[model samples]
Target: MLENTQISILGCGWLGFPLAKHFIAEKSTVKGSTTSADKVADLKNAGIQPYVFTLGANNNADVYRNFVAESDVLIINFPPKRVEHIETLYPAQIQEIASHIRFRQKVIFISSTSVYQNTNDWVTEDLVNQPEKASGKAILAAENILREKLQNRLTILRFAGLFGYDRAPGRFLANKKELSSANAPINMIHQDDCIRLISAVIRKNVWGEIINGCADVHPIRKRFYILAAKKLGLQPPEFKEETTVSFKKISNLKSKMLLQSTYKYPNPLVFVL
Candidate 1:
């Protein structure tokens, strides 16, 4: 069903860039946006019709409106920066984007599994009301805004920690001291599986649903990080002794059942670079 469809991805950064290429490979017309004019050449070289865009409460609407008007599907891949005052800026930008799009068009919102707090329980898409961090709260707020505006035309995908290519988390805390949550179960997804699930959702025309995208296995924090570090010949991270444990395992059953996803990396521990 995607073959001749026009797809536009807003904020074509790490994930969105590859996703745009994926759709283009599937014979779909792909248009992508970047805030940096320097990156326009990169997107154009990757076979994506590139456009310059800056989204916010007061930003120009004609650019975004024109981008949305040309596509059959619009993917909101804009993520809030990890800085102070992100909580307010995140939803404001989404609200502005929501005002430009019509309810009749299809929209896929990129959300995060962080919306589920560390409740030490198995979490699903239904538990989005319990965000623990600023980023989670911001994402949940954006999801709500888009859902209300687009209604049934919207689909929310709450992806777990995305790690693949040069984005490995093992190197993030290498040789770190006194790290907490050593025993907390990790919920991460490879970039390959993420693209597959999203492609399936669009091909099947699945809308008006919330899906969690993650791997099946849940490895403890220390174990996964140590192994990941060793694979790269990097210093293994040290974790403090655990006196209190709190974590959550993100369940991907909704995605499997609804999106019909068969993961490429079912067991995260065996995932090799």
Candidate 2:
């Protein structure tokens, strides 16, 4: 394990802040980025050296080059919000990053399980990514760019729906609003588990691999949220349709076998309830 390695995190928002703190706790020098100038002081206060960066239709190449050149390991955690012409903007941002990434520096790209299409079958790292949605296709393209350019130095972490801390699952469905797809399978991972998985990758020097960073547990959507609301003494959200909905069940086997990681929140219900 590299006890004193330097790690740079681009896009220090919800997931990025926690990730930066985790690395700092492990004695790594962390450089976290945010588009907002105001967040720099906050990041510095949290023990991360902060950089102001924004990725969109107009990206400053010089800023990206300097950021990538200064670190040993780079974590790309930013996602462009859905907007007009996002399809074009997403790949352009990725290309800018790829062009600037220093040679030999390790990279971990935080992708999403949304890359998997709505298929009933289980999806693993081995399955071909045939994204049905435009966002998923954009992410897949970004992943491909990193993989092709970085070769053996890059690791891709495809996380499921994220919920933990300020993003409590129960709160999302506590009101008497109607819920869609009641029987849809839920695949989620807590913020703590995300940190642990990233730590494991850094510690074990796991590279050139794509791992699913999600909990093993799969529960029906309605049951999961209803139980969460009940636990919190709130009225359960009403279900609109109780029909079966298909999703590619994510597997964390690769993460376990490669990094030898044991999940901090293996069961999503534990935190949901």
Candidate 3:
């Protein structure tokens, strides 16, 4: 049971905030950190032990140290910023956080499916990742950094395109032009699924594993987005009519075999805004 498990989430943003609420409801002791001081009260009101902390900067040494030291499990949920020198800077940022983490402390690092390059086919956990995007490369590097630091004590979860809740797909490409890969598959997951999957990880005590969190079905990009747009009554984005398009279908077989749970929202095309 997650009851009484001391959990600390590094970044209490979209995904982390809901996760905190879930853990709290399950009777787990949740201590969450937010970069924004304005949001501190919000976290506190919701019964989370809040810390207004930032990595690689001026802050209280004792507070930060205690925040990490008191947790049974530390969740690294912050996403790397989209900026220049991310290849080096991102890992360095993670290294700073990793430093505060005890050598034997269990950790869960939230990763992205962007680590895997678009091979125009089904991609699995063991596939060699050769990401072309800067963000993807940075996330992969951070994963490697944490692996070297925490090895078997770490559990890395790579998630596909995040949607559902306040993050609707209709706003992504609404009324946009010149969108390519109309036939490309959309490998996405819902926030509800993400929270359940993470809870399963902590509950099952699954560590030293790289699990992929994604939906069961892959929907064509054009059809999925258009349907999503119509749901929100937004202008459907235009896409090129490509007979053949490159795509990468993220395989969730490992997550299924491990978690043994079904996705609440399996089809992205039916993803209600």
Task: Report the number of the highest-lDDT candidate.
Answer: 3
lDDT of 3: 0.89
Worst 10 residues of 1 by lDDT: 53-62
Model 3 over residues 171-226: C-alpha lDDT tens digits?
88889887999988888999999998899999998999999989988888888888
Candidate 1 local lDDT, 1-273, one digit each (tens): 789999989879989999999999999999898999999899999999988867763567787788888677899987898979988989998888778786477999989997888878999777647788999999988988998788889999999988988797768778888898999999999988988988998999999999999999989888888888888888988999988999999999989999777999988888533
Instruction: Please give the RMSD to the true structure for each candidate, in Å.
Output: 1.5, 1.8, 1.4
Number of colliding residue pairs in each model: 0, 0, 0
Clashing pairs in 1: none
Each model's C-alpha lDDT? 0.87, 0.85, 0.89
Kindly list the per-residue Cα lDDT of model 2 for residues 77-184, writing each as its tens digit: 987569777677787788887888888899999999988887786789888889988888889988998989999999999999899888878877887666777888
